[model samples]
Target: MNRKLWAALFLAGLAAPFLIYPVFVMQLLCFALFACAFNLLIGYTGLLSFGHAAFFGGAAYVTGYLVKNAGLTPELGVIVGTLAAGLMGYIFGILTIRRQGIYFAMITLALAQVIYFIALKAPFTGGEDGLQDVPRGMFLGLVDLGHTYHVAGKPLELNLYYFVFIIFCIGFWIIHRAIHSPFGQILKAIRENEPRAISLGYKVERLKLLAFVISASLAGTAGATKSLVFQLASLTDVSWHTSGEVVLMTLLGGLGTVLGPVVGAFTVVALQAELSAFGSWVTVVIGVTFVVCVLSFRRGFVGEVLEKIRTRPPGQND
Candidate 1:
C-alpha cells in the first residue's frame, strides 16, 4: 500500500532463494522490473513505443559481448549496456518526439525493426549462433560464483538467483522514486492532459524525452542482467516478440500500479514454465491471455481488483 511496505517486500525477496527455486524467481523479477520500466513511459507519459525489445534484448547482446570478449565484470558490463540503451533511447526519442499519435509509435517500431536486423547480421552476436558460455563472474570480486553443480545429477546453484535479485532491487527502487517524485507528478499530468500541462509551461516534449530515456535505460538494465543469468545472448533477446511479451506484462498488471508488473511478470513466467510441455502452444496460450486481459479487464488484474477495494458504493464498510 505504501513505499515502506514495498521496501519490506523487496527485502523479503532477497531471502527468497532459500525458500524457493531462486533462478526461476530471479528470471521473473528481471521481467517484472523490465515491465515496470516500460510502464513509466506508456502508463504515465501516454506514449506507446512498441520497440522496447531493442532496449532489453539489445542490452543483453551488448553485455554478453563486453563480458565475454572485453573481459569486463558483470557489473561493468551491465552499466555499459544501460548507457548504450540510454543513448539509443535519447537519439530515438529526439527524432521521434516530433510525431504525435500512432505515428510516433510506428516510427519507434520501425526503428526497432532496423535494430533487430542489425543484431541478426552482427558477427559479435555470433550470427544465428549467439554468444554463449558467459561467466557469471563475481560481484565486485567478492562472492565466489564457482561452477554450477548438480545434486544427484540435477543442476542447482543460487548464484544467478542472488545476482538477479540484487538487480531487481535496484530497478524497483529506481521506479519507486520516479513514481513518487515531482517529475513523476509532471508526467502524470501530461498523461491526463498534455495540452493543459504544456499550456502551464511544463515543456511537455522535454519531459517525454526524459521519460523515454529513463524507461529505456531500465529496460537495458534488465536485458544486461538476463544475459549474464542465461550465460548467453541470442537473437531471441532482440526479437519483436520479446517486446510484445513485456507489453503483455504491463497490461496484465495494473498499468499505473507499481508492484503490479512484478506480480504479472511472476504469473506469466510461471505459466510459461508450467506450459513448457506444450511446446509452441505456450505462445498461443499467452497470446490468448493477453487478448482476454485487454478485452475483459482493461484496468488489468491488479488495478481493477484494487479499484473495488479502494472504492465503496456510498454504503459504509466496517
Candidate 2:
C-alpha cells in the first residue's frame, strides 16, 4: 500500500509489454482481478462459494453476445455483463445466506451447475463451440481498441492492454478501498465470529449479500474483459474447474491479504503457460505445489512471507 510500491508496480506493468507478450500480461491481469474478487468474499466475509464460475463465465457469455450479436460497444457490453453478474449474485446470495458452511458452498455449487447446463443448452452460447470471433469494439465508440501504436518504432498493442490495465486498476482500487472501509471491518468481524457480529446489531445477511454482489460483479468485469481479449466465450470459463482454479489462486496467494490473489494468479497463470505442453501433468505439478504450500506455508506464498516479516523479532535479519 505504500506509494513507492504502487509506483514500482505501475512502472513494472508499463514495461512488461516490452519484455513479455502483451496478451499474456493482459490474461494475467484479468485472472488477477478475478482472484481478487474471489478473495473479497472468502477472505473477508468468510463465505466459501464454490460456484463463482457462474458469474465469471456468465458475464463473459453476456458480454460476448452483446459485442458479437447486439453490436454493442465493448465498454457498454462489459457494463451490462457486470451488472448481470451482480444481479445473479444478489439472487444467489439471497438463496444461500440462510445456510452455513458446507451447506452454503453446496447451494452455490448447485446454482452454478444449473447455469452451466443452461449455457450448454442455450443457442446463444453456441454449446460446445461457444461464442467466437467477439469483436473488440471501440472504447466509448471513439478510440479504436484494436488499433496499435508505434512505441520506439515498434508497433505495440498498447490500446487494449492499456484499457484492460485501467479496468484492473479500478477494480483493484475498489477492492482495496472496500477492505479498508467500515463495512469491510464489519465483514471481518463477521468472518471472525458471526454470532458476535449479530449480537452487535449488524444486519449480517444484508452486508454479506452486498459483499457477494460486489464480488460477483467485479469477477464478471474480469471475465468480460477476458472475453474481449481472447475474442471468445466458451464453456471453459464456466466449468467447475475454473471455480476451483480461482480458489487455488486465492489460497496460494494468501487468503485475506491484498496483493496475494494477484501474485497467486500470476504464478498460476505463468505456470500453466510455461508447462502447457505437458498436458495433464501440468495440473499434477500445480496440485503438488499447492499441497506443499499448504503444508509448509499455510498463509500462502506472499501471506506467509509477509507474516514472517511482521512477526520477526526486532533486529533479526529478514
Candidate whose TM-score is highest: 2
Off by over 4 Å in 1: 1-4, 146-156, 313-318
Return the TM-score for each candidate structure.
0.93, 0.96
Candidate whose lDDT is highest: 2
- What does candidate 1's lDDT look like per residue over 1-318, in tens digits? 566876788688876766667677768887998999999988888888888999998899889899888888888888999999998899889989877879988898888888889898976778787789977787677765545656555565666677677788888889889988999999999999988998999898899999999999999999999888788888888888888788788889878888778777877888899999999999999889888988998988889988898786677776
Please state the error at residue 162 of candidate 1 in Å: 2.0
In candidate 1, where is summed lDDT lowest over 10 consecutive residues? Answer: 144-153
Per-residue lDDT of 169-246 in model 2, one digit per residue for the tens?
999999999999999999999999999999989999999999999999999999999999999999999989999999
Model 1 / residue 235 / CA error / Å: 0.8
RMSD of each: 2.5, 2.1
